[model samples]
Target: MNESKPLVEGAHFPLALSRPDLIPAARYSDPDFFALERDHLWTRTWQMACRLEEIPRVGDWVEYECLGRSVLVARVGEEELRGYHNACRHRGTQLGVGRGHSPNGFTCPFHGWCWNLDGSNRAVFAPEVFDPALLEPEALRLAEVRVETWGGCAWINFDDRAPPLRASLEPFATYHDALGVDRMHAESWFETIVPANWKLVAEAFMEGYHAEQTHPQLLARSAKSGYSAGTDPLGFVDPEDIVGSSLYFMRTLSEGMGGGMVHARDIEVAEELVRMDLPDDPVEALSEWTTRLNDEIRSRASAEGADMPDLNALLSSGHIHSVNFCFPHFWYLPVYGNAASYRIRPISPEETRFEVWTTTLWPAGDQASTPREPTRRPHDDPNWGEVLRQDFANLPRLQRGVRSPGFDAMRLARGVEGTIANFHQALDGFLAEREHADLLPALHGVSGPIDAPIRDLGL
Candidate 1:
């Protein structure tokens, strides 16, 4: 539990913060609030810049852009990474556009000012053309941005005073580490521009309450046996049938998402599970099946020399949350040694860039190949899979609906939508510029996986 504290006692503009269950509707559509986030929230929080695999070799770099600012993250050595403001010191020219290699370090195209991968001043186009004092080492070195690596991704923070990445992540890091998340790498990556605020788009995936409504196919397929037999009001006519239904659920979930949630190998394990004899009672059978499924998945992956975790132990300890929300703008849903992830960034008050990646564990002792640049597509592109397409359909509608004159605020469900509330509360702490000591507790309360009711956020 977190200590309750009033972090936004005097906040006047956003009326929603006064109530725990309500979110200001204008926060999604108002330019003023968005600017506040640009100046306060984005500048201080740790955010995923790029997957480590994207820059496998030295001199490789990826430019991460958010709220009009750009950061260039580079691989300076086999185990070293560095980030710099993506602007040249001379005339403020932008340094890099996208991901690429610059073996000779970054050279400003405008005037040929150069900085090494370590951010030291390498050369200036014409030393005699400027004041010698201006060409000093401190003046010419690239402005540094804080860079840290975790979960196989490079994260950047603009504020030098911000806490270390791991310290800020807390139980979120502990949970992911238990699941072997750092060993997983991107198998596929894609991106699309969404017609909504970044927060609205991210909130869409923060809970399972919408599963039955928004993703009816998933619910229907997974629950077919529960309501299949008309004669059995309780849907327990045949206990043995539960095995078949469970198999179908896994199969359909994997197929519907186009291999986003469960990997092909997981489906194979499910197929194998149905061949075994099981208990006659449905509850007992399900219990046995779940235990075996988790164990077998880990065993099979480990047999192939892939780094795998003790899934049964993790499940018993309640370490698996299905969907983990890294505060502000990142999420990863890991299942059976495979996972799907999301990274969201604001493009404007009403537009956002959303990216998705499917990740899986690689064989131990072998480095995973570099993931190709994400393929950008329209928000409604079929290639995003049926589940995501269905989720995307609601984003534009929600964005437009929030602006209605009659709509007062977004009333969040106390239990199911707790993560959404947690997000806003943490954002308020930043926007209010609370002291680090005062804000750290609230950050810890909101920095882990979701699927549970709201906890005391110390705010």
Candidate 2:
């Protein structure tokens, strides 16, 4: 097989994905690999802890726990957010549980020690009994974790040396900033415990190649594939094989496979879809409809004296789908009218928590109808919708298949699965950070970076 040029070519994803070694199946099941990931990927990266709206009032706090580590994000003042390790200084007791408003700040139940909302040591009982020199109140302050806010959400990082949130997430922040993300509300939020590795759950959404086989209902709106046979053996149409620019369209900034024009004479459209206000051609009709809908939304938001950004600019520029895979655990799929985002966290080597949040712009008046705080439920819950259910149904099977002795590694379809390859390559970059350092002395006589050797060998 010939190797295709890496779509996301850079220091982030250095591996040539055509090589089979890029798929390290053990990373999905091995406890030792999981431990290494917990040490490097989880701790050294910034995580989206909670939305700013979730803790709107002063003294309100949300406990974000993952992989045996916990953090408490609290609103100490009107606009100030702070994060702490969630453990008391005395006897190492958890400071808070779940979400609540602590007016007088958090008081440890195990001991009488209290920490102020600002994470300062407030008071400890029996202070006189302990030596003041040995027990300085200043030394007993809650350990603080770095906290920052962007796109109306609070992010926490355990590593003090980690770069600022904006710096760490460059083009992603730039892309999301174009759309009025701060102005959008969390229309719906849901979470579920999936019985699959965290990586397996995340990879499901990174590519659209599985849509035809997994979500055949989506083809009803496609004019090109209107009851037509797909080209590939999997009975799914490959976007890169036809339609749109292979390099920049779907791979970088544009919409996914079905962005082309819709067929008017196609027989696949359902009776309900055919009778709708859409035009004769459904695909172009959907695009035009999306533009008109955004125009109406802009007018309504203006009429209601609400501040909303012009998302139509993205549509015009062909930067319509700002699909970004923020490293470690977040996926932001921001479109012109509707947006969906996902977060995955590991509960163990086998179970992971998957979070789905859908966002839309609504006039300020619609705030009353905004969905409630996200509640965790099973994936089969009716509220998850059909497409999501279909996507999740394959995760456990993937987990089981990857562990089989017959399957050594995955042969990635580089043409269509480039995004997934980029993800795996980036993950390898993270895992190789320290391993490459140990080889520096071996190349004392050699010059330049040491990664060239590793990348060439497909390591």
Candidate 3:
């Protein structure tokens, strides 16, 4: 059996030698930088449009708008899904607003020209009113965009030459495949508008370095090694005793920078539900818990005639939370069968539409009967929890602080913030107008290790 490799394992992270240790303050608050991203990055990457369940039925559609560009994804048949630019061929009117069933097709509210679910022209109200050549079916049809579905989500790419989504998301896709995120369903969903640069909001969750300050409650555990210099030591008195406590146990197993553990608020709260009482053997308890949980799920699935993988096998090998940033704007954090996702849409240099989505494996015999529309909430919404709220509040302040005359750049902690630094290197490559094929090498200062697994994975 192949042992699972830790996500942040050494020899996997590359250093861009020429890259500055200090990230420019302007990158976070400069409108010009944001514009460069809109023009070069967002326009060329594969972006998550909607969950497949959101448009499960034929004719059901969802519209995704980002960086002043809008796309419409629709299901045209039981297995057919397609995407198009969300504008009418006629007077440049929008074909769909938000989301709904348009079984017959989309009709332009402005001119009544209609488009079929396949984006083909169905009828033009006044065809003779224009030249015959201009009224050709191809000319009148909605401009089609590339769309693909994987892991229960529909992804769209505006660039015609963009590589397949799976290729762009390699090794991470391997993790998502094992967890079967495609089989999971949304448990709760919401988006919050944060008054901060998108990059500022994204970088906040990329590392656990901030837990000692941003989320002090997480390290409030009585465990001695709960908090280290700036990172969590994750050293418990009894390794076996750690299994029962939520944060302590999971943090014990969820490896991060320098082989130390990292803690996030969701993981902290999740740990609370499990018994924290002392165990005879912490390691054995964790092993048993994983075995029993996997068995229970398998049994339930069999009884319900549903299908589920034996994730215990996968988890045992090395199932740390996988943090994957699908470049330009999407971030996915998948742990076991549950995931929390973030999508950052830039409205301007200082404003962004930050979306947070959570999904978990659906229990056998239970499924939502209706599609869910995302709920928009303020940063302080009680539903987001105190820890999450704390992170949200810190972001805007960070944005403001970066703008201070005294602040020139950011000093990144390479061990803890390697991923963030790698991201900036990738961003610089894009801003320099390099192709994706050549861009990733910038992560290694020039070219990364030829056999480096993460070199192509785009971390």
Candidate 4:
């Protein structure tokens, strides 16, 4: 989701057409490019849906939409979280509005054709006229799609035969046990109606390249230390020990949980540095620290007119945020070491909606360490609210710049560009494989930023 442009501000324009394979600004301004992404990339990809805990009981349901289709997720029991088309069988109206609880079945508001939790038609509006097909369970039944869950998340595909979620997430399962996704609960969530594509949203998280430039609040501390983030030969999010004294909080977590000798490993190190004061059990240390930091920001944000407490509580649980960038489009950012969360949304052309699903380690029937208190909802958070406001202010501007005939391409620095490139590598892979993605031709000639390996001290 993170990106760089072909030009800069109030300065001499340096046309860095380094990556010749990619069309300079196709992702930003091209409607055809967006169409291809919608048709091939999103529809074919397995997406992060609700966490298994969201609908713990039979008949619980959640809604999902991608590729212009609204998907309804329902749980018939503890084990099943299934997807439907979200349309009522009778009137063709959306079965559910925003999001609410449906105890045992979803009765359409249109004509009252009720569907069981298993997606079967339990009661048809008019059962007699087409009685032959009406009585034939399948005819009146809601259309079912594919569902799968992993790393404490639920995923669904409209194509029943799409590869299982596990197959798509290769070599990632080994680290799943550390995520503790199932033990988490929601802390807080807020949405930004961004005027850019979903890729713009992702670009923010893709790398630390823009940290100093885009995130001044975080840079106040991050700029002070030993951080040199870049890409490895394989294009991973590489965070090495920082060069100087200033460092960010995430370094602690990264160093603590690091096992992979890949790019994102640096983030693990950064997080570990952040949690330096945490307990011996890095997980416990991570959880405690997250709750404290998240709460502080929430309190300050609310005081400023931008705090959303209920959402903050969901985020501060310490269980979510441990896992960052869990997949291509979603970020399982466990701000605390103890928990993890799911941040995902499809880029519908120039518009995108971000869904932040939070969770704690505690499952149904399990006791949570944090006392169960009345959850309060709020309108905004000032401290963190300003943070996002800043992003929203800038991203759309970046999206706008891609359209100018003056700009050509971007030039990424070695250390600061890793996260951005890692994301692009993933996107490139998807585009190359997609039949609709003829966009690969635009990015073919971009040269490598770093050679095979750039290690300090040559371990």
lDDT agreement with native, every candidate: 0.81, 0.63, 0.65, 0.50
Off by over 4 Å in 4: 1-23, 131-135, 216-323, 339-342, 346-348, 357-389, 413-459
- Across 184-242, the per-residue lDDT of candidate 4 in tens digits comes to 55544445445677766766654554555655444322232323332111221122212
* Top candidate (TM-score): 1
Kindly report which residue stretches of model 3 are placed more than 4 angstroms away from their true locations once superposed: 1-20, 220-244, 247-306, 364-371, 440-459
Candidate 2, 3: how far from true, in Å? 21
Model 3, 359-450: lDDT tens digits are: 65535235444236778898767666555777897987898999999997788775666666666666655555566666433433312111
Q: How well is each residue in 49-134 modelled by candidate 1, as lDDT tens digits?
A: 99988988999999999988899999999899999999999888988899889977998889888889999989888789889888
Q: Is candidate 2 or candidate 3 better by lDDT?
A: 3
Q: What is candidate 2's lDDT per residue for 1-459, written digit by digit as tens?
A: 114543223223222233533565666788877776787667777799987888989989999999989999999999999999988888899989888899679999997899889888888888888878857767888889999998778999988876678666655666677776776666667889998889888778766678679966544322334333332212213331222111212222212222211111111222113233544443445455445545655665566665657757776755555345666677666654335677889989889999877665545353345554677789766655666777778888999998998876676675555555555554544455533332222112111111112222123
- In order of appearance, the predictions have TM-scores of 0.93, 0.77, 0.81, 0.63
Query: Which ten residues in a row are the worst by lDDT in model 1?
Result: 229-238
The TM-score obtained by model 3 is: 0.81
Clashing pairs in 3: 16-445, 240-282, 246-271
lDDT of 4 at 420: 50
RMSD of 4: 12.3
Rank all candidate structures by their TM-score, best first, as comma-separated numbers. 1, 3, 2, 4
Can you give the lDDT of residue 395 in candidate 1?
95
Clashes of each: 0, 1, 3, 85
Q: Which stretches of candidate 1 lie over 4 Å from their true place?
A: 1-7, 14-16, 220-225, 228-239, 362-370
